[model samples]
Target: MTKKPRLAVLLGDPAGVGPEMGVKLLARAENRDAAELLLIAPPSVLAAGEKIAGTKLDVIALRPGDPLRFEAGRITHLVQPEPAGFAKLGECSVPAGQAVLQALTVATELAKHGAVQGILFAPLNKHSLRLAGMDEEDELRFMQQRFEVPGFTCEFNITDQLWTSRVTSHVPLREVADLITQESVGEAVHIIDKALRSAGIARPRIAVSGLNPHAGDGGSIGLEEIEVIAPAVERLKRDGLDASGPWSPDTVFIAARRGDFDAVVSMYHDQGQIAMKLMGFERGVTLHGGLPVPVATSASGSAFDIAGKGIARIDGLQHAFDLCVQIAARA
Candidate 1:
């Protein structure tokens, strides 16, 4: 008999679509059958989600240090002691951020200690985390530091089975040029290739994008493509990773979408993000690639405007959860 993987599911920011989506995700019987889930959140938050979703669920409550047993189609809750302070529906508050931080901390700890094989969390509002006093620029950095993982880590934007990884993420446009070195480009290619294979692809084909317009038009527009990007592609090819690039950014995505490539290695954040979101904003899933344990969430954020209205789509979260389960089972 095949063993079901145990996954940590965190309810992100009670004020947003995370809670409701979490409810919608678990409400489906097929999702429950895919893995053994541990939902980490406060009781009040779950109650609010149930109210919004108009669905009731039974959870086995447990305290810290309790022995966990995996049951297909069942969920166990590690209830937070304090239930107060999460922001009301559709509003951002410090308490909401704090709750998200705490829940993520607990979930990461479980992964670190081998209690869980993968993690699936709902959408989080960056503003809420900043309000909660998060010093890091984003959750990925925080997770990396907390886990003490000493390797390349990246956020891979995936849609329609096509993946994109960036050479530099969350940096200013002015600083992007200087940061696009051979090492950075090579690392992005490496991670994206490994990530695609982990998702069940064999011998992934990768396309690398140029930093300048029209691939620098043979070094007339910019030298970054000639001096940095092209060289990186050649080195990656020598390493036998099935990589090719220095393609013009304008046409690379089009080529990949037409089945020419498996993944695209972008130079910066928006370079690939804008296109992926346009391809299928609602269906995109962001995998926290290069982590020892799989971690993922929606490529989009908490849609506060439509939150708690019982209309927030569960497509993205469903994809995230499904991918997490797939990766965990393989791991």
Candidate 2:
């Protein structure tokens, strides 16, 4: 028999749709086939999800150092519940933040121990991260610190065909001016390079988007294209990456959507996300590149708007799982 791929599934934000969406995904037979799902959540939270998902799930609860409690068609609980926290549905609270952090802590521990093939996170709010006193950096930075991982790490969200990234992430627009340096854009190119290779793309055709309108109108509009962005693209070409552009932000995405490029590297967060979300927001799934182990992607948070409504989509989680499990097989 093919041994199942072990997955560390973290329940982010007990108050939101993480648990509920998790239950919905695990109950699908397809997930069971791809991997063995383990839950890093409090028992009460898993039970609540089971109740909300309308299934009599056999979630096995366990403590640290205990044998994995995994069972077919069930979630193997790996952590003790928080001492006290809110367990409400569809409402965000301070306690909800604490719960999400606790879940991430457990997932990281599993990663450090090499007990699981990948970390599959549900949505976790950035605000929750701050309330938990976790330094409030994005997951890409946090995971790097938590696991002591060396080298650059990046987050990419995949829709049906489009893949995207932020030249600067989780930072202020004011900071963006200073952040758009040759080094920063070069870092993005490298990330796109590594990520494309991981996603099975060879000789990736990378498209670089401009920070200013119409690629700075050939220095007729803005100098950022000439000063910062263009230098990076020149360096990329010299390094032998199939890289090109300082293209018009307006048309680069349309070009990528038409298969002109393998991935599009944008200047900021919304530049890439706005289009990806528009293409198919619910189908938008996230991926982390440059990690030694396959890391399953998810939202920065839970979507309480559809929590317990049985309408929240798990396509993101499903695709993330498929990405990790398939990679695990090759690894």
The C-alpha lDDT values of all candidates are: 0.88, 0.76
Clash pairs (backbone) in predicted model 2: 123-301, 123-302, 124-300, 124-301
Root-mean-square deviation per candidate: 1.4, 2.1
Model 1 misplaced regions, further than 4 Å = 83-86
Q: Which ten residues in a row have the lowest lDDT in candidate 2?
A: 292-301
Alpha-carbon deviation at 214 in model 1, angstroms? 1.5
Query: In candidate 1, how many clashes are counted?
Result: 0
In the range 125-232, model 2's lDDT, one tens digit per residue, is 777667767783676677777788876566777777677776887788888878888988888888878777866787888899999889999889889999989889
Report the number of the highest-TM-score candidate.
1
TM-score of 1: 0.96
lDDT (10s digit) by residue, model 1, range 1-331: 1677788998788889888989889888898889888999888888888888999877888887787765556688888755446487788888899888888889889999999999999999878888898887688877887898886789999897899999888878999999999998999999988888888999999999999889899989999988999899999999999998799999999999999999999999999999999999999999998777999998878889988898888888899999999999998
Q: Estimate each model's TM-score.
A: 0.96, 0.93
